[model samples]
Target: WQVFRFAAPALMAGNAALLKHASNVCGSALEIEAVFREAGFPKDLFRVLLIESGEVAALIARPEIRAVTLTGSNRAGESVGAAAGKALKKTVLELGGSDPYVILADADVEHAVQVTVQSRLTNSGQSCIAAKRFIVVPEVREAFERGVVERMKLASCGDPMLESTQVGPLARLDLREGLHRQVRESVAAGARLILGGEIPSGPGAFYPPTVLSEVKPGMPAYDEEIFGPVAAIIPVKDEEAAIAVANDTSFGLGAAVFTRDLARGEKIAKERIEAGSCFVNALVKSDPRLPFGGIKESGYGREL
Candidate 1:
């Protein structure tokens, strides 16, 4: 999606494209290039390079490269942005996020819970803009937690190719291990495991939908981006506290606030929340019509 998002604009603007995709998704990369060729694009105009990661810096530094764009972690973004900067080339980076999904006291609890379950578990929660943090007012904290756990349990976990599989495996075994490490550390740091904390005994890189309650500052679930099917629920006293907690993270990619009062949700989502994209009574998503990016350590420059 990101590859096309940026490539489409560049192609429309009469610029060529060179894609160096993630090693795990090489087939998809080749298919994208094939699609462009079949669509009447000049063969040389759109290309996919199966190059080693070490070769990327030199490629970006080439005079003909002109510009660079990346979608990955902050560490990877820093490395790419630095190389591009040294080459004095334009660059766009879309990095990791720990987006906040706030449920206000006046929110429709059922609606918020359903949308949040969908948003957080989409792509097995591997998305950069997925709502990782759940900040709910004290009045509805227990109800939100219960609803989330019950709803999350219903998500079928198995092979992604199966249409009924709602929660699929992580992209790799290492990614699943890393996510479990975060979950373990957070649990040790006092974040209570509400449901699905155990890694299932299986062959594939599958993990169940896990939820952590009472997550607060100092826990990895609170501070770091858990790029897997894990949910961190943090309870706050009031709206002001909710906003304060939402803005507490270093990454500012996206956020959401659910409230029956549209005016109040708007004020907090548009003005108070510290994120590039904020939604009121809805989930955050990337639309072709809107510019998508992040602020602070998340990334800089827009993609679509």
Candidate 2:
């Protein structure tokens, strides 16, 4: 979806595109290129480059390469932006995110929980706009935690080919290990593991839907983007504190506020949420009709 998000618009604008896909997904990238060719578009109009990350600088430096678009970590964005800037090239970067999902005291708890679970678990929670932080008012904190844990416990994990499978393995074993490390460090930092922190003994890169409670500053679960099926629940005293915690992060990709008070929610979402897109009583998602991007350390420029 991401590969096509940027490519489709560029192609529609009659601009040639050179895609530098994530190394691990090279086959998928090639498939996209093949599809375009089979559809009778000129072959030269679309190309996929399978090259090492180190080779990107040279590619960007080429005079023919007018622009660059990257969707990756902050580290990759920094390198790509640097190379593109040095060559006076236009660059679009959609990097890391620690998006906050705020649950106000007056919110519909059931609806909020449902949206929260779906948003946090979409794409196995490996998404830039996925709800990484759950900021809840103290009055409903316990209820929210319980609801999240119940939904997570019901998640079925196995081969993604199976229609019944709700959760699948990570893209790679190294990614699974990295997520486990973040879980371990967060637990050690005093966050309570409410559910699913274990790395299952299996052939594939499988990790269960994990939930962390009492997440606060100084903990990885609270401070960093854990790009997996891990939910960090941080309880605050009120709306002021909830907004404070939401804006505390350096990444400002997307954010959501859940409240029955429509006027209050909209006011806060528009005026206080420091993100590219803010939603009231809903999960943050990218729509074709609206622009998608991030601010602060997440990245810059819009995608779709």
Candidate 3:
């Protein structure tokens, strides 16, 4: 609700907003519309467009729609951005991320463990900044491995409807299959799977939360983001190597640094991280008070 936390006041400030969420979250979308209506917003003040991806451009091209904001794939953002551009209108996008999570030799093991465990489990690891890349310095690799393994073992993997479930199925069938393919290809490219390599046998589109170790550059997994529960762990020899590996990917969405040395963290935060937002000594999470966006193929513009 962080979004609504700040956006509600903005909405009340006379500027209306429309939301076109993921098709799977229709119920939540409509309920958001209801909240605005109940708050005495004009019927036209808050609109929910339950539209398909194939038709977003047409909707955004409407003469009344002055600006458009979108959150999804880079392809989707390009389409919407192009359409809005053609209309000579403003458009903002919060596109997908292949964010990196880095831990230097001086990192706090327990702190990194707690944060990485929580980062990978956020929104069941379907989040944009959910720590897709786990880069650790060699000196701390074994301890980080042990820490992550212990925590991963503790992650509840079962029905989302269950109160104790920490991991759930991917959002849709295609998402499941695509992530599975990434796993297969990444493994084929010599990436070692310390955890979760196979698909879970199930009726729903469920994929077990997975972690990969010995992730080196040149693998397809390194080149692209796996948009599910799978996390790729990369170990580097030094902080420079870690920074190089972290920035090697095309994505520049969010980058995180976990280290005890505040000076080094500040240096990386200011100079090394190639992202719209960089977090020092913390995992990245979006906020309504600050704008969030991406650079490179992750897409462009901002959203708050």
Candidate 4:
């Protein structure tokens, strides 16, 4: 949010701003309007349309909306993209990622392992760039796998309304269904499980942190992004193989390489990644100033 305070002026310069906030955060939508209104923006110049889902298409197709910016589901991105495409409106999509977290042999063993686990479950694993896949080198694969699984099991999922809850509820019921389906598909495809595949006992949509090893390509767990606390631990022979496994996914939204070797980090960041963004020594995600998007089916437009 701090980034936006600085970035919005530079990016929105000479361009009218149109915002489509997430469905659940209407209060945030109104707050955005208040900010613009407080800035003395003309009523007509800054409009926040909190309309029915069906009405979004009409608004996007209007001549007034010259460009579209979105930070939400990939499915939502497709609908917005279609409307914008039809109306010839420019689109900026900050689609969330099923990002990969790569751990090379030369990576700092303890720090890399700890951060990998943390990144996987950060934001209740709700982040687009929360490290979804943990790709580890052969030498450290067993250690990394054990470390991640242990940490996952220790994740304290409970009431978000609680002060100490580490994991919160899904935004809604349907999202939990989607996550459950993904988990089921992965298991059916024969991926080895490490921990937490079932929903915890609660009214809230809570799944314990899940860990899987021997995640071969083509398995639902390997190819698809598990949006929950599910972790896919894929083994690679060396740095080159790690890069290959990292790039194998349709998503190149972001990547993290944990290695002291700065040169190898550069190579992975420059040559191996298919993502619009890359993180050499840290886990990857989006920011307001730095643009975020993906290649292939992930979407084309960048968000800044």
True-structure RMSD, every candidate = 0.8, 0.9, 1.9, 2.7
lDDT string for model 1 (1-304, tens) is 8889999999999999999999799999999999999999987899999998889999999989998999998888999999999999999999999999999998999999999999899899899988899999999998999999999999998879998988998999999999999999999999999898888896988888999999989999999998988999999989899999999999999999999999988988889999989999889999999889999998999986
Query: lDDT of each structure?
Result: 0.93, 0.91, 0.81, 0.76
Clashing pairs in 2: none
Q: Indicate which candidate wins on lDDT.
A: 1
As a TM-score, model 1 comes out at 0.99
User: What's the lDDT of the predicted structure labeled candidate 1?
Assistant: 0.93
Question: For candidate 4, what is the TM-score?
Answer: 0.89
> What tens digits encode model 4's per-residue C-alpha lDDT throughout 170-250?
777788888878777777788787688887675767777888788887777787777777888888888788888888877
- In model 1, which residue pairs have backbone atoms overlapping below 3 Å? none
Clashing pairs in 4: 97-128, 252-275
For candidate 1, give the lDDT of residue 182.
92
lDDT order, best first, reads: 1, 2, 3, 4
Instruction: Report lDDT (Cα) of residue 151, candidate 1.
Output: 94
Candidates' TM-scores?
Answer: 0.99, 0.98, 0.93, 0.89
Collision count for each candidate, in order: 0, 0, 0, 2
Superposed model 2: Cα runs more than 4 Å off: none
Kindly list the per-residue Cα lDDT of model 3 for residues 1-304, writing each as its tens digit. 6336435755767677777777789898888888878988788788877888778777778887777767778777778889889888787677778888889998998899888778877877888888888899989999998888778877888889899999888889898888889888888889888787677775888787677888887776677877877778898989899999889988888988999999989889889889989898788887767877778777777766
- Candidate 3, lDDT over the whole model: 0.81
